[model samples]
Target: MSEAQDDDVQEFAASLTRMKERTDRSYGQLARRLNMNTSTLHRYCAGDAVPLDFAPVERFAALCGATPQERLELHRLWILAVAARQRSRTAAAEATGTAGTPPEPAGEPVQDPVSPEPAGEPALDPVSPEPPHRPWFRRRRFLVSAAVATALLATLGSLSALPDDDRRPGASDSVEAADPPRATRPGTPRPKSTKSPSPSPKTSSSPSAGASKKSSPKPGERTEEPSKGPGQQRPPAGVPLTWSADSHVWQAGCGHDYVIARSPRQVPPPPAPQDAETWAGTQNAVHGRQTLVEVSVQGRTSTAVVLEALRVRVVGRSAPGRGSSYAMDNGCGGALTPRYFDVDLDKDRPIARPADGNDSGVTIPAMRLPYRVSAEDPEVLLIDARTKGCDCSWYLELDWSSQGRTGTVRIDDHGRPFRTTGIDGLPRYSYDTSARKWVPYS
Candidate 1:
């Protein structure tokens, strides 16, 4: 009916298309909401045909929280949109009227049956019995819009605070959904989506928003920004250590296959081969002196395998980081391995084919580490990870030929082997000193 009304209708139509794309609603779901045949609904949103009595369909647009002005324009488009296609017919009417000397050709536009005058209150005696009015709040759709707007603000703020480095993992990440794995160009900063702290329901209208988790900051410790580098291990030839884990997807263990070639992120080739005896095989020679270790993740039951080759056996004691106390028992299963197997190391106990008991158990405390392994090698390479809040010596050693490059797994104080921190040349133990942190001579 007016220039402003036309603009509103065009905008309303555009908004509808966007909403359809954002959620997972099926075509049938949308069709039910639009109250039209699914096929026809698709055509209308594409700007194909203008409908008649759009008031019914226009109400559905309310979900978008469009303004009252938008609704009015939508209604106008329903009635007058086809006018553009009927220009020739209008011209014919005017010509006939002029020839007959009709009352007034100018008033013809106002009396068109398709579109009527402004106010849209209907031209049937404007003064006769006014209709009941709708309260302002009743017409306003506030809840849905406010929720959407609030989540947007929080997401923006979260993205703004991420770090610049790569190769670090936090347990806050969700392993299942992995919220965000591939690092996007830093358009904004946010924590690892995988690091969504144990879910807490954050649905409130007041100051408290989002879920809450226990605090783990050291006395004056601050929450460090996260990095998005690939592989939990660090790259070679950097400072003390440089590591990044894709949180849930971080490559953890003694070694990985050639599939790393498929990663969109750039990575270095595998380590070169070296002394077969020193780098390839370790002796699993422990007898009558083994401890039963089993590993279970989350709340799931554990299926423990007595680390058949007790290669790196500890002869002495060790602490958080520094040490000559740590030792490797080197029991190579009569052969090398990265090969997954199930066996009982105890000969007297008769190795069960599919045994029923816990042997070597591993529970990765709370970490979003994607890579962790059970190996006894002294020199571990945790490629491309940044160290913070952890106290462990890092060693980067060259190795090859161990079960076709099975590599090595770094052991933590718990006697569990975790993935490399991506720090080349890092050791197994660490100690914080006033001047510096040092390692034992190899």
Candidate 2:
């Protein structure tokens, strides 16, 4: 080997080590940015292989925010590495390559790593088809964890990949990793600081209100309870939606109009009063972004179509002048999805009206929940029509008994699919990654 070639090997090794240590990035995050994996990253870092693709490396550089000079040098080195590998493989094949040899019979065991380099340089091992695994233990687990922690943010199912632009292998992602990420509704009052440091409310009442004279605060004073802003409560990733049944019993909307509640598998006609509207439908599609499902039911005279969109949004945080902008359209009868509430609540019925609320409330189910609404999906109303309510975990009780004994639909919020007391009576689905689908959570 020439002196220059040997120098190149050492230089490449040093550069790789620098890249690994210089940035504390995880294989997952780097993969998302570069669209590659840990094993590939391991090889690249170890100078085991020059990439056939430049994307992952480029992504890493981008994450590192490499300087112009550094970027240029990286490409230059990458090209040299590739060229060397090609030459070595070519010479080895010409010398002792079994270029077209057939495989041995079934009983044969594969040999150890075969050198593809004609010289003494080590041969490049082909990547095994299986993913790389750590033993029951691994070194650098913490570093790998930090990388993964920084990236691989859990997102909703109809995945809109985070723009590669927002990602970095560094600690600062620009977007505040708030407990409950604070987002403003469109058209709502903007704070002087859009990304304000979370505020602590100033207690106004006397500190000793309703207390004995000695314990009582002055006439203008008040006692205060510990209060944290909405941002203080963020649901951790992968945490199941804790079931919280309302102490208030669910009352069907409108005194006389009883909505039929049934399971997805029963075929019996609901025991309906002659005056009740018997709703039925096929579990066609659930456009959760719009928080609505499209249902088509068959009856004696004709088929009934109903667009059921779940209503969840942040209260008080909705933009002062926004609503309906993010609701999904069911696209029925030549109508669009979220095609406006079938019956407008704002105009007719009594949706919850916050006495202190400045704007009118939009129509939704009697049970409203605070969900990552509009700020997450602009086309959905959760962003525009905001409201404040108890953080009640909810699952729409869908009765599919009209279809079959086995009709069911899994409700997936935040990519973790869970089977709620599935029938009107029991929600039982849990996400089992091992099973790769929703199993009974109960």
Give the count of colliding residue pairs in each prediction: 77, 53
Off by over 4 Å in 2: 1-10, 99-442
Question: Who wins the TM-score comparison?
Answer: 2
Please give the distance, in angstroms, between residue 404's alpha carbon in candidate 1 and its true position after superposition. Answer: 45
- What lDDT would each prediction earn against the true structure? 0.30, 0.31
Candidate 2's displacement at residue 263, Å, is 82
lDDT per residue for candidate 1 within 372-430, as digits (tens), equals 22111011112222222222222112111111111112222122222211222323222
**lDDT, model 1:** 0.30
lDDT of 2 at 25: 36
What tens-digit string does per-residue lDDT give for candidate 2 at 1-442?
A: 2345435544654565576443323343355566565556656766666776666667677666577788778877777776667766776776774576543445323342231223343322346431234221122344467568656654342256555345333332133332343233222321111111112212336646524332222211222233234545321111111111111111121111111232323323222221111121121111111122122112111122121223222111111121111111112131111221221112222132212111124322321222221111111111111112211122222111211111112222322211111122223233344644433333
Backbone clashes (count) for model 2? 53
Error of 1 at 73 (Å): 4.3
